[model samples]
Target chain A: MKSLARRLVLAVPLLWLLAFFVAPFAIVLKLSLSRAAMARPPYEPVFNLSDGFWGLVESARQFTFDSYSLLLSDWLYLDVYVSSLRIAGLATLIALLIGYPLALAMSRAPAHWRPILIVLAIAPFWTSFLVRVYAWIVILKDEGLLNHALLGMGLIAEPLRIFATEGAVLIGLVYAYLPFTVLPIFNALDKQDSALVEAAMDLGATKTSAFWSVTFPLSLPGLYAGALLMFIPAMGEFVIPDLLGGSNDLMIGRLLWAEFFSNRDWPMASAAAIVLLGLLLAPLLLFERAQSREADT
Target chain B: MPRIGASGFAALLLGFAFLYAPIGLLAIYSFNASKLVTVWGGFSTKWYWALLDNRLLLESLWVSLRVAFASASIATVLGSLAALVLARHGRFRGRTLFGAMIYAPLVMPEIVLGIALLLLFVALGLERGLLSIIIAHATLGMCFVAVLVHVRVKMLDRSLEDAAHDLGAGPFTVFFTITLPLIAPALLAGFLLAFTISLDDFVLASFLSGPGSTTLPMRVYAQVRLGVTPEVNAVSTLLLAFVGLVLLTGAAIAQRMRAV
Candidate 1:
C-alpha cells in the first residue's frame, strides 16, 4: 500500500510532464519538419496509427529541412536572431549594472530589514508583467510623464522619441527582469563571510581594492546566474518587443508571432521556436551550473 | 556590516526609486479624468466606473479569474506531489530527470512553450479555449509551485513524521495531520504564485485561448498595443493593488509560520 502511494505520487507529475511538456517538444519538432498546409490545423503529414506501418513511412518521407534552410537563407530571420541576441545582451548588461548595486544594498542591510528589502525587490515582479510593461508606455510616450518631468526640469528642449524604439524595449526588458538579476546576486553577497573582507582590508588592501579582489570573485557564480536568468528570458521575450518595438525593431519572438498568427505558417514558426530553444540551451546549462556552484558553496 | 557608504546608500535609494517610479505614476494616473492618459486633468474615479461598464474587459477579467483559480488548484496538487518526491523520496531512480523536468519550465521561454503547446493541442485535435488555457497554465505553473513547495518541504522537520510512524500512524495519516499543516504556508504561497502566473499570463494563454475566450491580459494587450488609455491604466492599477494585497497576505503567513 505504501509503495502504491509512493508510485502514484511519482507517476502523476512525471507522466503529466511527459505528456504536456515533453511531448509538446516532440510535436513541435515534427511540425517544424513538416510542410505548411493551407488547412484548418495548417500543417501537413498529420500522422495517425490507423493507417499502420506504411502510413508512418509515408509521413516520415514528407519531413524536410526547408523551413530551417529558409531561416538560414533569409536575411530577415538572420536579422531577427542577431537583433534578439543584441537586445537581450544589452538588457542583461543594463540590468546587471542596476541590479548589482541594489542587491549589494539589500545584502548589507540590517538583519531585521533584509526580508523587507527582499520583499520590496520582489514586489514589482509579482505584479502583472504586462501591466508593468504598459506602465512604461505611460512613462515613455511623447507627452508621457517622463518627458513632462524632463522638459519641466529643462533636461530637454522637446520630447525625445523613446517610445516604440529599441530603447523602449530595452527598458521594458530590464524592468521586467530586474528581480531575477537582483535575488541571486543578493544571495551570493549575503552569504559571504564579512571576515574575509575584513581580512583583506587588514592585509593592507584598501576598501575598493579589497572589494575588487575578494568580494567580486566570490560573487561570480551569482553574477552568472543572474545574468543568465535575465538574458535567457529576454532573448525570447515576446510581449515586451511586441508592445514596445517599432516596425523595424523585429525580434525573434515577434517574428515567430507574426509568422504563426498573421502568416499562418506553422512550420516556419516551429522552426523559429526550435532554433530559439537551441540558442538558449547553452545559457540554460550555464545557469544550472552556476546554481549548483552557489549551492555547493 | 555597513557595506554601503553614503554614496552607495544614495545609489540604492535611486535604484528603488527607479523600480517604483513607473508603478507609482501608473497608479496615480489611473484616476486621471483626462481621456489622454498622460495629461493630468484632475483626480476622479470615473475610469474605475468605466472599467465596470466595459463588457469585453469584464468578460475577460472573469475568464482570467476562473482560469487562475482552477489552474492554481490543479498546479498545487500536482506540484505538492512533485515536491514530495523531490524533498522526501530521495535517491530514487531517474531523480535527476525528474528534477530537470521541474526546473526546466522555470527558465524556458514562454514563446517556445506557447508554440509547442499550441502545436500539441492542434495535433491532439483539442479545441483551443478555457480548458486548453487551464491545462497549459497548470503545466507551467506546476513547475513554479514545485520549486516553491520543495524549499519548504526540505526545511520541514522529519522527526515529527518519524515519531508519528513509530506511534503506528500510517504515511497517509502522518501526511494529513502533520505534514500538511506544517507546510501549509508554502503550499499557500505556491498556490498564490501559480494563481498570479495564470492571471498575469498573456503569451501562453493568447496562443491557447480560442475566439471569444480572451483573458484579461490578452484584452489589455490588444488595447495597449493601439495606445495607452486611462482604462488600461485603471485596470492595471487594480491588478497591481490586488496582487500587492495577495503578496502581503503571503508574507504575513510566512511571518506567522516562522514565529511558530
Candidate 2:
C-alpha cells in the first residue's frame, strides 16, 4: 500500500507536467513546421488522423519547413534576433555593474541590519511589475520629472528626449530586473567567510587586491546566476520595450507579437519563438548544470 | 566584515534611490488634483474615489484577485507534492527530466510560455477565459512553489519522520501528522509567492484571457498606453499597498516560524 501511494504521488505530478509542460512544446514544434493560412486556427493542422493509420503517415508528408525558411531568408527576423540579444546583453551588463557594488555594500553592512537591507532591496519587486514600468513612462516623458529636475538645476536648457528610445528601454530593463540581479549576488556575497578576506589582507594584500583575489572569485557563482536571471527574461521582454521603446527599437518580442497578432502568421511566430528558445537554451542549460553541480556538492 | 568604503556606501545609496524613486513618485502623484502626471497640483483623494466608480477597472481587479487566489491554492498543492517526490523519493526514474520540467518555467520567457500555452489551449478547443488564465497561472506558479518548498524540504530533520515510522505509524499517517505540520510554513510561503506572481502576471494573462476577461495588469497597460493619468497612479498605489501587505504578512509569518 505504501509503495502504491508513493507511485501514485509520483505519477500525479509527473503526468501533470508531461501534459501541461512538455506537451505544449511539442505543439509549438509541430506548429512551427506547419504553414500559415488565412483560415481559422491560422496554421495547417499537422495530421488528419481520421483517415486511418496509413492516412496519418500520408498527412505527415504535408509538413513543410516554409516558416523556418522564411525566417532564415528574411534579414528582418535575423536583425530582430540580433538586436534583441544586443539590448538584453547591454541591459544585463549594466545591471551587473550597478547591482554588484550595491550587493557588496549590503554584504559589508552591519550584520544586525543585513536582513533589513535585503528586504529593502526586494521591497520594490513586490509591487505590480506593470505599474513599475508605467512609473518609468512617467519619469522619462519629455515633460517628465527628470527633465523638470534637470531644467531646474540648469543641467539642460531644454528637456532632453529620453523617452521612446533604446536608452529608455535599457533603463526600464535594468530597473525591472535590478532586484533579481542583486539578490543572487547578495546571496553569494553573504555566504562568503570574512576570514578568507582578512587572511588575504594579513598576507600583505591591500583591500582592493584582497577583494579581487579572494572575495570576487568566490562570488562568481552568484554573478553568473544573477546574470542569467536578468539576461534570460530581458531578452524576451515585451512590456518594457512595448511601452518605453519607439517603433525603431524592434526586439524579437515585439516582432513576434506583430507577426502573431498584426500579421496573423502563427507559423512564422511559432518559428520565431522556437528560435528565441534556441537562443536562450545555452545559458539556461549552463544554469541548470551549475545548479545540479551545486546540489551534488 | 570590513567597514564599507565611501564608494560602496554611495553605490548603495544611489542604487536604492534608483529602485525606489519611481515607485515613490507614483504613490505621491496618485493624490494629485491636476490632470497631468508631471504637473503636481495640491493633494486630493478624488482619483481614489474615481477608481471606485470605474467598473472595468474594478472588474479586472476582481478577476485578478480570483485568479491569484485560485491558482496559488492549486499550485501549492501540486507543487508541494512534486517537491516531496523530489526531496524524499530518492533516485526515482526520470528524475532528471522531472527536475528540468519543473524548473523550465522559472527561466522560460513569458512570451514563449504565453504563446505555447495559448496554442495548446486552442488546439484542445478550450475557450479563452478565466479558466484558461487560471490554468496557465497555475502551471507557471507551481514551478516557483516547487523551488521554495523543495529548499525547505531539504532542510527538514529526517529523525522525526524516521521515529514516527519506527513507532509503526504508516507512511501516510507520518506525512499527515508530522511532515505536513513541519512544512506548513513553507507551504504558506509558496502559496503567497505563487499568488504574487499570478497577480503581477500580465503577458500570460493577456495572451490567454478572452475579450471580456481582462486582468488588472492588462487594463493598466491599456490605459497607460493610451496616456498616463492620475487614475493609473491611484490604481497602482492601491495595488502596491495590497502586495506590500501580503509580503509583510508572509515575512512576519516566516520570522515567527524561525523564532519557534
Candidate 3:
C-alpha cells in the first residue's frame, strides 16, 4: 500500500507528461514519416487509423522514406540550416567572450554586492523579450541613435546602415542572451573553492597563471552550461532573424515558418522540425549533468 | 580586482551604454512631440495620453491579464506538486526521464512547440482561442516552476517533513502544512516567472491566438511592426514599471522566506 501510494505520486506527473508531452511529439514524429493528404478543412492523413489495445490508436501507413527523401533533396533547405548554425555558433562564442569576464568580476565582488549584481543580471529578463528586441530596431536604424551619435561626434559624415544587417542580428542575439551566459558563469564562479587559488598563489604562481590553471578550468561546468542554454535557443531563433535581418529567407526557422504557414506543406514542416529536434536532442542529454553541478551549492 | 584601470572603466561604461541606449532612446522618444519617432522633436506626453484611449491596446492588455493570471496559477499548483514529488521522492522508475520531460519544454524552441501544439489542437478539432493559449502557456510555465521549486526543495533542511510525519500528519497534510511553508519562496518565484512569461508571450500568442484574442505583446508587436510610434514607447514604459514592481515583489518574497 505504501509503495502503491508512492507510485501514485510518481505516476501522476509521468502520465501527464506522456499524454501531453511525449504523445504530442510522437504524433509529430509519426506524421513526419507519413505524407499529408491535402483534403478540405478536415484534411485526412494517408494512413489507416486503427485502435490498438490500451485505448491507443496507431496510424497504418505503408511507411516509406519519401518524407525524409523530399526534405534532403532541396539545396535551398540545406543552405538555410547551415547559415543558421553558423550564426548561432558565432553568437554563442560572442556571448562567452562578453559573459566570462563580467561573471568573473561579479563573482569576486564583496559578498554584500552579490545580490545587487544578480538583480542587474536578471533585470533585463523582466522587460518583455520582444520589446527588448524591438528597442534594437529603433537604435540601429540609419537615422537611429547609433548613427546620429556617430554623426554628431564628427566620426562619420553620414548615417550608418547598422539595421537589417548580419551584424545587427548578431548584436540582437548577443544582447538578448547575454544574461543567460552571465548567470551560468556566475554560478560556476560563485562555487569556486578560493582555497585552491590561494594555494596556487602561495606556490609562487602569478595571478594570471593561477587563474588559468586553477580558476578557469574549474568554471567550465557553468560556462558549458551557459553556452548550451544560449546556443540551443539561438540555433532555432525565429524572431531575431525575422525582425532584424534583411535577409530573413536564409534561416531554417524562417523556412520552416514559411513551409507551415505560407506554403501549407504540413509534411515538409514536420520533416524540418524533426531534424531540428534531432539537433536539440544532443544538448538536452548533456543538460542533466550540467543541472546537477548547478544545483550543488 | 576591486579597482580597475581607466581602460577597464571605459570598457565597462561602454558596455553599460550599449545595454541601456536602445531602450533609453525608445523611452525618451515616447514623449516626443513630433509624429516622426526617430527625429529629435519637442517633448510631450501625447503618446501616453493617446495610449489611454486606445481601445485595441486596452482590450488586448485585458485579455492578456486574464490569461496570464489563469495560466500562472494553474502552472504553479501543478508544478509544485511535480516538484515536491521529484525533489522529495528522489527516485522512482523513470525518474530521470520524468525530470527531463518536465524541463524539455524549457529549452524546446517555442516556434517548434507552437507548431506542434497547433497541429494537436487542429487534429482534436479544438479551435484556436484563449483555451488553447492558456494550456500552451501552462505547459511552458510549468517547467520554470518545476526548476524553481526543485531548487528550493533541494535547499530545504527536509528533516522537518519527517518530524511532521512522525507527529501523525499524513503525507498530504505534511506537504500542505510543513513542506509548502518551507518552499513558499520558490513557489512565489515560479508564479511570478509564469505570470510574466504568459504576459510577455508573443510568438506563441501570434500562432495560437484567435481573432480579438491577441495578448499585450502581440498588440505591441503589431503596433511596432507598422512603424515606430510614441504610443509604443509609453506602453513599454508602463510594462517596464509593472515588471519592476513584480521583481520587487519576488525579491521581497525571497527575503521573507530566507528570514524565516
User: Which candidate comes out best when scored by TM-score?
Assistant: 1
TM-score of chain A of each: 0.97, 0.95, 0.88
Write down the TM-score of every candidate: 0.98, 0.97, 0.92
lDDT tens digits, residues A97-117, model 2? 999999999998878978889
Candidate 1: list runs displaced more than 4 Å.
B253-260
Error of 3 at B246 (Å): 1.8
Interface RMSD of each: 1.3, 1.3, 2.3
Which consecutive 10 residues in model 1 chain A have the weakest lDDT in total? A288-297
Clashes of 3: 0
Clash pairs detected, candidate 3: none
User: Per-prediction count of colliding residue pairs?
Assistant: 0, 0, 0
Per-residue CA lDDT of model 3 for B134-172, tens digit only, reads 888888888889888988888888789889899998887
- Clashing residue pairs in candidate 1 are none
Greater TM-score among 1 and 2 belongs to: 1
Q: What's model 2's TM-score?
A: 0.97
Range of the 10 consecutive residues with the lowest summed lDDT in candidate 2 chain B:
B1-10
The candidate, 1 or 3, that scores higher on lDDT is 1
In angstroms, the error of model 1 at A99 is 1.3
